[model samples]
Target: MNWYLKVLKQYADFKGRARRKEYWMFTLFNIIFSGIAISLDNATGLAQMGVGPIYGLYALALLIPELAVAVRRLHDVGKKGIMLLVVLIPVIGSLWLLFLLVKDSDPNENAYGANPKLIPV
Candidate 1:
């Protein structure tokens, strides 16, 4: 949960490296929260009423942060944050991005900043 909170605290920050644990933990919580919101919305008949699910609202609010974290995660792997644009290429692009995100951060860092996982906390 600290990982998730850390990412949220950073918010729109896109200038640093983010360890895989930080990025993946935040993503796990985001999916969990969104699922809960969607369940509640469905139970309340929001979907039937065309009022939309709370998950949609939550996702909209955090879109920027999500993108920023992803970019930072890419940076952690020594790739330019702009490489995130590859997602726009459909299936292959998204799979490649997933591969990148799951990769270990550069051991010694490569300009974005020190490896968060290697820094003594």
Candidate 2:
């Protein structure tokens, strides 16, 4: 939860490195919340209205932060944040991005900034 909030606090920030915990925690919470919102919409017949519920709006609200975190996470791996565009390539693109996101951060940092995992709390 802290990780999720941390990402939200840094929303729109794409210039720094982000630890895996930061990225994945935010993703996890996003998924959980979206699922809940969708379920609520379906249960309440909002789905019949074609707009579903608030999930679409919530997802829209988070899209920027989600992209920012993903870019930062890629930076933490020593890759350029622009590499996020790889998600447009289909299966291979998504798998490659997932692979990149799961890798441990570069210990000494390359160019983005100091390792978030190594910074003294």
Candidate 3:
């Protein structure tokens, strides 16, 4: 939950590294919210489809932060943030980003900064 708040706080940040917790936590909340919107839309029948639009707008607004986090997360892995775009190749792209997200962070700091995951709370 704290991680979700962290990303929102950082919002447009694209220069620093991001820990896996931060990325995944934000992802989780996004999914949950989208789910609720969809559920609401379904529960109220087509007349309530407006719920989907609301959440769909929410998602569209989040695109920058999502991309920012993706780039930063790749930085944590010591990879170029641009590597994120490689995922555009369908399954390969998704798999690549998934690999970076789950892959271990660099053992030492790279250009982005000290490993965020290693920062003492």
Candidate 4:
């Protein structure tokens, strides 16, 4: 939860490196929150999603953080952050970026910052 909020706090900040725990924890929280919002509507038997607007805002709020983290993560690999653009290449591009995203961050540091994975969560 702290990781998720920390990412939000650093929203659009592309300069620093983010560790895998921060990135994946934020992703996990985002998915979980969105699921909870949807589940509320389902449980209530309401025709409309009761928390639709809230969840929508949650998504809007996190977009910049997501982009910044991805770019910085690429930087951690000594790769140009713009390489993230390769993710746009349909099936091939998306898979390629997914590979980069899943790979471990460099053991120590690169040009970005300290290894995010090494930080004590």
Candidate 5:
């Protein structure tokens, strides 16, 4: 939960490196919350009325933070943020991006900043 909140605090920040733990934790919380939102929408009959309003609003609110954390995660792996566009290629591209995100951080800092793992909490 701390990791998720940390990412939210960073909000739209697209620079710097994010630890793998931070990225994955945020992703986990997002999935859980999305599920909850969808359930709420369904229970309220919002889904039958139209699009799932709650889910749509939740997704919209997190879009920027999601991109920011992903960019930072790529930075941790020593890739440029633009590498995120690789997801556009096709199935292979998304797999490649997933591989990149799952990769461990560079032992030493590159151009992004000092590794999050090395910094004292």
Candidate 6:
């Protein structure tokens, strides 16, 4: 999907705001790909040997991009990227963070940059 590739292209970029579509699409594709990778590792007997090599490698490669997109998603909601740390608190923290991420973006730009929805993309 274009959204998934877009996130990958940005790679480790942690600046700017990412529209909800971008973040959710990336998450969707990441889940699909991870499933495929795990399936491949299991089919190849890699899981029995150790951590599924394919899944492990795939997860490791996407770690930075995942964080970057999440930070950007938080920015879109007008929250500081540091708010991502709230996920470490407990069940409530994760629920709160989910609430923030799903919350609509600020209609106007804040500190991050112009809203992607408002930009003539």
Best by TM-score: 5
TM-score of 3: 0.85
Error of 5 at 30 (Å): 0.3
Per-candidate TM vs. native?
0.91, 0.92, 0.85, 0.77, 0.96, 0.95
TM-score head-to-head 3 vs 4, winner: 3
What tens-digit string does per-residue lDDT give for candidate 6 at 1-121? 9999999999999999999999999999999999999889988888965449799999999999999999999999898889999999989999999999899999997999998998764
In model 1, residue pairs whose N, Cα or C atoms come closer than 3 Å (at least 3 residues apart or on different chains), thus clashing, are: none
Positional deviation of residue 97's Cα in model 5 after best superposition, in angstroms: 0.1
* Residues 1-121, model 4: lDDT tens digits: 8988888888888897877667778878888988886676567664263655555666687778888877876776667789889977889999988787777778877777787667765
Candidate 2 error regions (>4 Å): 48-51
What is each predicted model's overall lDDT from 0 to 1?
0.88, 0.88, 0.82, 0.76, 0.95, 0.93
* Candidate 5 collision pairs: none
| lDDT tens digits by residue: candidate 1, 1-121 | 8888888888899998898998999999998888788788888888655435587788898898899899999999999988988989989999999999999989996899988887864
The whole-model C-alpha lDDT of candidate 1 against the native structure comes to 0.88
Alpha-carbon shift of residue 58 in model 4 (angstroms)? 1.7
RMSD of 2: 1.7
Among the numbered candidates, top lDDT falls to 5
lDDT of 3 by residue, 20-61 (tens): 888888899978878887776667673253566656677788
Q: Per-residue alpha-carbon lDDT of model 5 for 1-121, expressed as tens digits?
A: 9999999999999999999999999999999999999899988888955449899999999999999999999999999999999999999999999999999999997999999999975
Ranking by lDDT: 5, 6, 2, 1, 3, 4
TM-score of 5: 0.96
lDDT tens digits, residues 1-121, model 2?
A: 8888988999899998998888898999999998888888888888755447477788899999999999999999999988988989989999999999999999995889999888854
Worst 10 residues of 2 by lDDT: 47-56
- Cα error, residue 115 of model 5, in Å, equals 0.8
